[model samples]
Every structure is written in C-alpha cells, then in structure tokens.
Target: MKYMKWPVLLGILFIHAVAAAQVPVVTLGPDFAEPGDGWDKLMQLKNGNTFYLHFSRKEGLVVNVYNAGHELTVTDTVHAQLWNTADIESTEIDGIFEINGQPVLFLQQLVKYNPVLYRLVLDGVSGKLVREDKLGELPSVQFRSVFVDDNLASHDFYVEKDPESDYYAVALFSGMPVQKTDSIHERIQVMHFSPRHELLHQGWLYMPDTTYSYFSYINMAVNGKEKVYLGTVGFNTKRNGSEIKPKVIFSALSPDSATFAHQVLDYTAGFANVGGTIQVATSTANVYMLLHVPAKQGEGNSSIILNTFQLSTGKLQKHVQLVFPELARNMEMNLGYKDTYKGTPQRFMLNQDGTSTLLLENFSFFKQGNTQINKLHTNLGDIGIALLDTAGKENTTMAVSKYQVITGICEPFQLQRRSKSEWMFRNKIAALNTNTYLSYDYIPGQSAAFVLFNDYLQYLDTGGQDRVRKPLKYAVDANFVCYRFYNGKMERLFLFGMPEVTKGYACMMGAADYNAAVGTYATLLISRKGLEKKANIAWIKF
Candidate 1:
C-alpha cells in the first residue's frame, strides 16, 4: 500500500496521525429525493447491482436500483398487499437478505391481531418485486419488542445467517397465555432456510416448564444448516410459585431431531444472565457467553465469568473468571466511567487464528425526576473489546472512548393495544434523528479488522475516562473515524479531513454494505445542503 497526497485533504490536518496513508478514491452519484421514516438498508447483489431499501410506516417499501457506478436507475414502491397494509403498525420488517442474487425481504403483518409472516423477492437489477409468498403464521400469541424502552427498541423476532454457508434461521418469540390464569406464558418458534430460501427445519422450542418457569429472551444464533441456538434465562418460582430463580439455558434445534436439545449453563441464585448473550465462534465448535456475578454480600468488585459450550453436543466446555483491572491495563484504558458504568456485549468477531474477540458496548439506562417530571436516559457510547482464546481464556482487552445521547420531550404514541409506546416526534418529515447518523459499522478482514464510527476529536487519547459525567456535543464535533486493528494493536485515523467531511454530507454508516470477498464497503453519504437531501453511495476498498 502506497501513500499519496489527497487533493481534498482540506484545512483540518492531522499530518502525523494518518502518517501519509493512501486516501481512498471516492465517487459521488447524482442526487435523489430523501426517504421517509422507519429504517434504511443498503444491499449489494451478486450481479453487481445495488438496492437502496427504504421501509416506512405510511408509504411501505420503496426500492431504488443503482448501477455499479452508484447511479440511480429505477425507483419504485413495491406493490404487495402485505407490504402496504392499511394500518402501518400491523406490518414489521422481519428480516432482509440477498438470497441467490435477489433481494429477499421478510415481512410480518398482524392480520386480525394475529401474526403472519410473508416473503417478497425483488429483482436484483430492477428493484421490482418478482414473487410474494406466505411463509407461515402464529395464532393466540403476542409478538412485540423484547426490550422496549424510551430509548431502546429490541425485537423479539430476529434472523441469524451462517457466515460459512448460505443457511439462515428465522426465529420469533411471543407471549402465550389465557391458560385460565393471570400469568401469560411465553413461547418461541424457529424456522431454518437454505440458500434459496428453502425451508430446512421448523419447530417450536421447548423453553422450559411451561407453567412453573418463564424465560427471558436474550440472544439467538444459527450454524450451517445443522443447528439454531437460542439463549435465554429461565425463571422458576419456589414454594407454591411466588418467586423466580433465573437459570441460563441454551437450546439447539437440529434437522435430524424432533425436539430441541437443552443445556443449562448456570443455575445459581447468586448470579444472573439478564443482559448477557451468546456468540458462536466460526473457527471452532464452541459458543461463548458472559455471566455477571454481583459482589458477594457487597464485599468485592463484581465479576464477569465467561462460559464456553460445545456447539455440537450442547455441553459445557470450559469456564474462566476475568480480572477487570488487568484487562483494562492491557488495553491502556480507564476503569472509572463517570462514577458507574456497565459493559454489554454487542458483537463478536471470529479471528483466523481460532480466537474470537468479543466487543462490549459501555452504557447505562436510568430515570431522573418525579412522576410528573420524569425522564429516562439511555446514556450510551464507549466500547470494550475482549480477546478470548479457544479455551475461553481472556488474552487481551481494548476500550474505546465515545459519547452520544437521546433526549427532549418524549410523548407516548397510543395504540389500541394495551402496551404503551413512545415516539420521539420531530417537526419535519425529512429531518432525521441526529443519533441515527452517530452510528458505527464493523468489517472483518484477513489481515486487519476495520471499524467505522463517528465521535469527538478531543477524545483521541486512550488514558482518560471513556465517558464523562456531562454529555458532549456530538452533533457539532462528530467526525468520521476509522480504526484499523492488527498485530494485537490498533490505529485511529480520520476517514477524511474535517473541512471536507463538514460539507453538508454525512455517511449513513448504519446502512453501510460490505463485501468480504471483494474487500469493498459501500455507504450512502446523505447531503444535508437543502431540505431535499441528496444521497450518494460511497464505496471504499479495504
């Protein structure tokens, strides 16, 4: 890799930081109309075509077909009965995938208050719907977000794709009840599909004692057509069922078996896996999970225990207790994060050397004020990375400094249903939430791993606290930063000069697309020069 002077390397300079790295050639496309609400997803098909999928509540699915040069050719709204439902709340984007060179979108509709799953296949080149089919349905069950709060929205239905193969698993959990009692029971269903969206395995997971024990949805993963793993903490009551003792369990659904194989990882009242999740290593047949152990009678610091389980047999392989101070020392990071902090696992990367690295997001959620003047704050930002060997031993840890927030008047969007929902309203339709632009994307490579995010420029030093007590002005100071990881260390460089990046255009990193085989990453750089914001796809090679 050779270094060259970038012509657009504007006034803001970090001469020594980049060390004269090769600047990626960027090509901008023609401007188009700005999209509406819901979410935006970009996908690159195998035929070298791209689809800019815009899913909204009132307008349904809008597809934009772009050529290899990133020029928009075709733009149309998908004409499907399920897609354009009369009531927008009834339809939800279950999952989106590019299957066999065509864009596949799984949609869920609550028809007559019952959930039904539908799949729509769009033309890879034209962005037009070719086929629509009814996949399956679930009756007498409640489907909703697993963790719905003022700032966070977690879905109960998720799709996990196999990194090594074309196999994928679609799983949805719902609250089931009306058992002539008050408590509503929980039920989960799984469906496995092949490369061409062929059904391979389907069944309802036997979570636990349907009556005595209730489970909390945590995470899910799928392996090459053979297994769909579901992680949950089963809660059971004692002495006439008045309380609940949490037990972390992993259930595997295979094609050859008629029922799920269950393995209990933790069954103690002293510890809980409330916010923990599972990571299936692609290099080896092992699944990793972190269990939080609170201080024993308030004597010592809290502990994070890592448990390794065999993927094939659903058995415990090994367990290790990590030292927080030592791990922080290795990363050269601060332990105190504005008095109190938390580490939540957000992603897992499988290295070529059979070691898996776990990435933890540092954040906290708390409420302030009394009843009439209450507010909930999801204080997010900052990161922690733990490198674990094959035996679940912690080899190293890394911490990242960040600062982001969401606030203002939050009013409840009332639905006919009993559950309350909060919708943060903005005055204009085209104006999006600033926090949406302050997102990150990750791409793993053969030689080095890359992370793309936006944060303050002053937080470049690694020794200070990752997050401060008072929130920083991310909207004014945010800049695109790229982190390259290799040889057990990392380097941070601004993707572009500040003057060039502040030119009304911002990268929608949350909707970025990456091709591991070709080593190219694409994202829509939306320009805010006018009310009609224009979008251009920016592609960079690794």
Candidate 2:
C-alpha cells in the first residue's frame, strides 16, 4: 500500500512539474543519424517551420524541415560533394534565415584555403533546394571561418538579415593592405541584396583611420527605409594607460548616395581601452553602444558606458555612463590582466517595449540576451545582466552565480598570469577546440529570462548538499540545465533525467534558438545509443 501511494504521489509531482514549472516538450525528430564529427543548427522560422541543417565531412549537407506540428516533413541533401572532399578546411552554417517568406540557407566553407559562401533557396512547402549560388567575390586573400587555426587567413565574412523586411547584406573583408598612417583600411566589399536574393548595390565600406590599429566588427543592420548601417570598435594600441581610449565608428550606406555617412565617436571624458568586448547595434534611426571601460584613474573596478545616437542626423540621443561601485573588483591591481568581476557587455538584447538589456559575464572562475540585431554569439562565461529602461532612467545590473570552466589550453588559470599576447592566444585557442558543449543560451522574457547550459548530473538535485568535492562532468557527460530568473532571483534545474553511460544525450546548447510568440525554446539534441549517434530536434516550452 505504501509503494502504491508513492507511485501516485510521484505521478502527481510529474504532472505539476510539467504544468507549473517550466514544462519541456522534448520531441525528438525522426531518427536521422549522422556519422561522427559534424555540426547541426536548428532554426525556428517565422512562418511556423523549423529547419534542422546538419553537415559533416562524410555526409556533406543534410537538412530536415519540420512543420508546425514538429513533424519531419522533408529531408534533402545539398552540396553533396562540398563536404565529402579530403582537403576541406573551414566550414560554418551562416544560418537559415527567412527571405521573402521563404527559408534561405546561408553557408560558408573553404576548400584548399579558398573561401566562398553559398546561398541556397528551399521550397517553402517541400523543403527541397530550389536554387543555389556562390556569393561575393571569394576574398583572394584566403579568408577562412572564425574558428580556423589563425586569423592570418586575411579575410572575414558575415551575413546580416534585416528584421523589418527580407533585405539582407553581406560584408566581405577581402584583405587589408599594408597599414598606412594616412589611410583607414581597404578592400571591404558591401553588397546589399533584395528579399528575393537580388543584388541591389555593391560598394566599398569606408573605414576609419589605422591609428587605432585594432578593429572588431560590432553589428550590421539593413533598415527597410533605404539605410544600411554598420558598427565597429577601434581601440588604441595601449597595453596599459589611464588615457587608453576606444572609439565607435558607425557608417551608413544608402542606395541613394555614393558615399557613407560616418559618425566617429570618441568619448574622451570617459576613459576605456581594449579591456573587454565592445557591443553596438543600429536601430531604426539610432545607433546604441555598450562597453565596459577601465575604471577611472583611482578606481579599482571597471565601468559601463552606453551611447545612443540618432543614426540619420548624427545627434546624440542618450549617453548613460554606468558605474558599479558596490561590486568593484579593484582590477587596477593586476595590470588590467585579471578581472575579478567582469563588467564587459557580451550581449545587447532589445526588448519589446522600447527598452534594451546588456548581458555581462565573469569567472572566479564561475559566476554568471538581445537583438539588434546581429546573429552573433559569445563563447562561454558566468553571468551578469544589465537592464536599461527607456520610460524611467532606472538601470540595474543583476549578477547570477554558477560554477563553470571551459577546459583546454585556454583554461581560466592561464588567463590570470598571461599578458595581452597570451590573452589573445586564448581567444584563438577557444576557436581551435570549439567546445559546443561549454556555452549557455537564454530565452529573454518580459517578466523573467531563462538561461540554459550543460552541467553535471548532480546539479539536477538542489537539496543543499555540498557539491564542492563532487567530480565535475562536462563535454559529452554533461546534462542540460537551466537558470530560470524571476523576482530578482534565479532557480537552477536540470532539463532531463541523469543519463546512463551507454545510452545518453548531449544538448548542443550553442545551437539553441527561442520563439517568444510561440513560447518555445528549440535546440539540436545529440543522442547516443551504444556506438551509434543520432541528431534530433528538441523543443521546450513554458
């Protein structure tokens, strides 16, 4: 009788967990298995279709399209010979974006050091490849993907899709000539394409002076109103200084004009350097930037600077300089090499109610959304979130704690003793191993935001038992977990039960996507059975 009561109570708890707490609808797609060493990207389309694109050296490219019922409708292979070659170098899924109510596949791959992009058009209902074309002038300078061995490949490529319409833009960095004192930079080709994948204009992106020496692409947006905007960061070559300054270069290219509208912003009053990542975005008529600058002359920790500017008229809208005093890290003690509490903005997500939020992360080595709209993602970090309000100038930075460390030559301890050169080495080293299992992705909400990642199985149980002595399980042995945030607090939980050794699954946390209107968070699941592996699409909804 006691056992029967326990089974009934367990069933009731499971039902309540599904209906009350975050309910997960983990529906694995059809049994589509692939050989080892491949990549998968799950995209939730606007027209209620989900496309799962998979690629490998052995399978070439296989795409599975699913309908709104989460039923697999079509499976087709594109570029069959492209990935089957032996000398293939760098390959990446640029993403499947909707153009003119149709799903268009964007891919970048290099064969024998030659880089090129592919634009594939699929039938909306059939999911068959309707068209395929090579995009841009292959950067003669041998530009490979970002995670490739060395950036010495000399070229960089990224695709930007317009949120307001089907228009998209491709900016291909051909190569930079020998740096000159008088010239900015050269060979950057910007091509604007229509929703139907038609080329509208092809021109050069006017860059800033080379004195800064370092340039990082921030964001790109194509406004439905005939304006295409690009944002970037240009910082000085100062390893350490109070006068260390970083600048924001916002350039707008229009079909009506032959030249670019440039706004070069250097906040001399607020001092910052290349101490962290710079995030900037282009709204309908304005450009916003968020960064963590080195603390003031005598201060110990870093500060946050948010700049909002009118895009067309080049007028300053709002300049919010944020300083977190209570949580200061006294970073001035470490020659800017060590950051005890990170303030660098990793993500800038625009909210629905005319407001935005910037997510910052730190590691001690553990701690821890946005649009505007670049389809870009950061590596791994702990967590710090900054919420900006437009109605009231009330701003708040919330810090959440979690223990995580991406193990490799790019381990966290090495970052403590390394110089700037060694720091840059870890930056590239992260790209070398490409641990898709180590990162976190979030589903931003109005009332509460949900953060998801992989962690140990013991993390599933939060009975206050000490986990300090427990062995850590990561990479393939990790379990999918979430940090659900609400009311200024976070509740962490595991998404699925603990997996056994031979039969288990690994959630590609980096490949996850969310649909707010649909109330679903989607990602690709890699399930293993004995020696066989399978790739399936999984969706979780609240």
Candidate 3:
C-alpha cells in the first residue's frame, strides 16, 4: 500500500491557522480497501471517463469507473490469474481505449526491459471483459522511454493517440538481447497500432556508430498525423575515453514507409566547446530543437541554440542563439558548478491565436554523497520566457524569478516514499489565460510564505533527511499560494485559501485530472485510521 506521511503539515497548522477558515469544494468516498490493500492507479480516458484501480494480493484488481459528474458508473475486476503470471508480480494498465466505440483495456507486465502486453476488450455498458489476448512482446528500454545512455531522461515512455490518423504511437529504448551482440548499442523501437489494438507498423532504429558509447539521449515531439520527431543529443566518447561535446540527430517518422527521415546537426564545427542539454518541441507544421552549450570552456554561463525545421518540406526554417540575463538572484545557493547559472528549455506551446511561446526553467543538481541512494538534490529555479512569431523568430525574451526545491527521502521498495512526494505537486500548473499561467507553491502553510528550494547543506548536515526524521503523521490540511506568470514575469497571486478539513481526509493528488466536462480539477486520496483505508476525492473549480 502507498502511504503518505504529513511531516510539514504540523508546521503549517501552527503558522497559517487563520488561513484555514476558508472552505474548499470537496467530496469524500466510502471505504474501498478490503483487507489486503495495495497501490491505487488513477486514470482519465480521452472521452472524459475516469476510474480508480486498486490491486490486492488475493482479490486481483478492482476498478471503479466514474463519470464527469463525479458519479460512480461501474465496478469491475480482473482476476490475478490473468495478470500475475509466471515470474511477474505487478501489472500496469497502460491505457483504456474505445476502439470501434467499445472499451478495451491495455495491460502490460514488465519482465526486465521488455513488456508482455495484453488487451482485454470490455463490454461498454456492463464493464465486463468480453475477450482477452496476449499482444506479444515488443523491444523497450527501461529509463523513461527515451534512449538515455547517460540516464538523464526525466520522463518515462511515450504513448499517444494521433488526433488526425486515429492511430496510437508508442516508443521506448532498450538494450539489445544477449544473443544479438555484446556491443553497447541501444535499440529504439517505435510501434504503431490501430485504435482496435491492431498492430500497424513496427520499426527499429539503432545507434549509428560506437564513437558515442554513451549516445542516444532522446527527446521527441509529434506533429499532426504523419510526423513524429525523435531527437537525440549524445556525447562522443571515442577519443581516449574522454567525453566530448554533444552532437544531435533527428529521426522523423515517414508515414508512407516503415523508415525514418534521419537528419544530423553538428555543433562542433566552429568551436570545441561542449553542449550541456538538448530539448525538442513541435507544432502542427514545425519542429523546434533547443540546445544548451557552454559559453566559454571554463565559464559557467550557458547559451541556447534554437533550430526550427518545417514539417512539410523537412527543411531548416530558422536558427538562432539566445543569451538571457541571470535570474539566479532568487536561487538559494550561488556557489559551486552544480548550482551555477544554467538554463534548460522546459516547455514549448503553440497557441490558438497563431503565436508560439518557449518556456525555460533554471535547473541544477547537487551531489551530496558518493552513493546511489541519497546522492543528488534537484532544484527548479526561476523561469525564462521567449516569444516567437509564426516563422519561429524570437520576438522577446523575459524571465520569471521564483525558486522551488524538491527534496525528500525516497527509500526503495518502501510504501512511505511512493505516493508521498509524487502526489504533493502533481498538478502544479493551470492555465489562467492565453499569456498567463499559474503555479502553486506548497510552503505557504508553514508561516514562511517563501519558496523553499532544498538546500544541499541542510540535507548533508541533517544526514540525508529533509529536516529531521519523525513519526509519520496523517495530515488533513493543505495550504498553498499561487504564483502568476505573465509575459515573462512572475508575481504572487493570493487567490484563495485551501480546505481545512478534518483528519483522515487528504487529496491523492497523484491521481488528479482536469475534467473539461465539469470545468473542475479532481483528485482521489485516502483517509487512514490505523490499518483502515478509505478513498476520498477533492475537487477545485477555476
């Protein structure tokens, strides 16, 4: 079972007790756990159908489907014999698809790097499995879908439904089988399937050369029906075991054939400098690539290179370099290379009004220990904005200075660490307007209304805990302050206060989703009393 311990809530209730007077819009559910309670998975379908699933050691998996009106629609179960086969102990439902206007569940059980998938077609009205089949195995990589030999991929696998083609695309990176070779080359497999779970196209791409033993760092962007750009930035280690500057390669899917339109961009022609990180973005008609390269060999300040390509012609549309002002005044620690001035382009969005925006977040990681368990502390500091015209030319550049830190104890194979940190800031951002976005900070409830970027000294000095390890307490109150980002600026927005509910009531923000049908955001959590667990929901309308 995934348990959440509220350590910060004690400080929150003592400091912001007055702010707890406001009532929040919320709803609670009855007890759903039966004896042996495990982890719960929440999902929202494309057609606005939502459900919460719970797995048990004896009873299998229980799914409770809900409509947009927050009403329970159906309850169904999939037996453990169907999923817990052979050596696999866990089963994950990748997606629930409505193929030919009927519902089907896509499940997978991972045995090492590969996944054994299953498709269970369900009767729409009754929520009963009409038919089931093993969809066979596909080649896949473990580290967040992208081909990250360096293990820096932030997200997991990439799975999406093409709006125009009505086809599903899935991609993952994995090592080659032992029988294939003992080489260091990684395999990137892209699979296409029909909405009815029919396999359409299966293709694989291999690393071109061994010069980049640590190659295949990938970031992808999809446009329309026919285009899926898989971009990679890898360091060349061919020269005497020394890591060199990163190079880029793009593999765009060709709809007509089972091949990719590969393109290579060289950043080492002019200088011998090294590139830091790379990101890719796409719109309906264009694809953009952003690369961060160090300004000078020893200088810590980094510069960005933007390369835009036309989707139709596959031609380079624009190339530009940008250098922004240091927004590190808000950064907590201004010392060392890890906390130095470095920028990473985080988001790119094409608006309905024909304008596009690029959002960049300041990032740094500090290594506390030499071990694997508690080594690095990640920090998200300040935001930078760049507005672009239709042709992908930069119009203006601005910066938003706000510091946020993510530091907590994450023990492997422990329930205390699973849902605790993952759910705290699940839905961190909400759109307020075309040019405005809002982000919530979780520290306003602690009397100090400031953003607490986790300090490395604090963590090391405290012997690897956030503050001090104490007994786990179940908290009911959640307080947050909103920060508004508009036209490249950041300002605090005191919209309203969070709910001050009783104990045993908390929001399972890990399962949050924005319901367009109801114009509200909802999440499910649990109220725990000793060994008893009950499912509850909290919704907020914006």
- lDDT per prediction? 0.58, 0.53, 0.44
What is the Cα-based lDDT of residue 167 in candidate 1?
A: 79
Worst 10 residues of 1 by lDDT: 412-421
Scored by lDDT, the top model is: 1
Top-TM-score candidate index: 1
Rank order (by TM-score, best first): 1, 2, 3
Residue 139, candidate 1: C-alpha displacement in angstroms: 4.9
Instruction: Give one digit per residue, the lDDT tens place, for model 3 in 39-145.
Output: 35455555555666554444566677777676678887755344553322445545554555445556677656666666666554455667787655645545333
How do the predictions measure up, each by TM-score?
0.77, 0.72, 0.60
* Tens-digit lDDT track of model 1 for 1-542: 11111221122343453433333445556766555556677787777777887766676667988898777899898888554444555566656777777888777776766677778998888888898988766654444333211111222455656656667887765544223554332256688999887888887765445632345665676787788887666554343354544556778888987567788765444234354445677567677765544332132233555677787787887777644444445334343444323454455555544576666555556675554323554555666656667654566555556565543321111110001011222313332345455535665656656667665555545334634444432333455677665555456655534423334445665566777676777776665533435666777777
Would you give me the overall lDDT of model 3? 0.44
Give residue 46's lDDT in candidate 3 (0 to 100).
Answer: 54
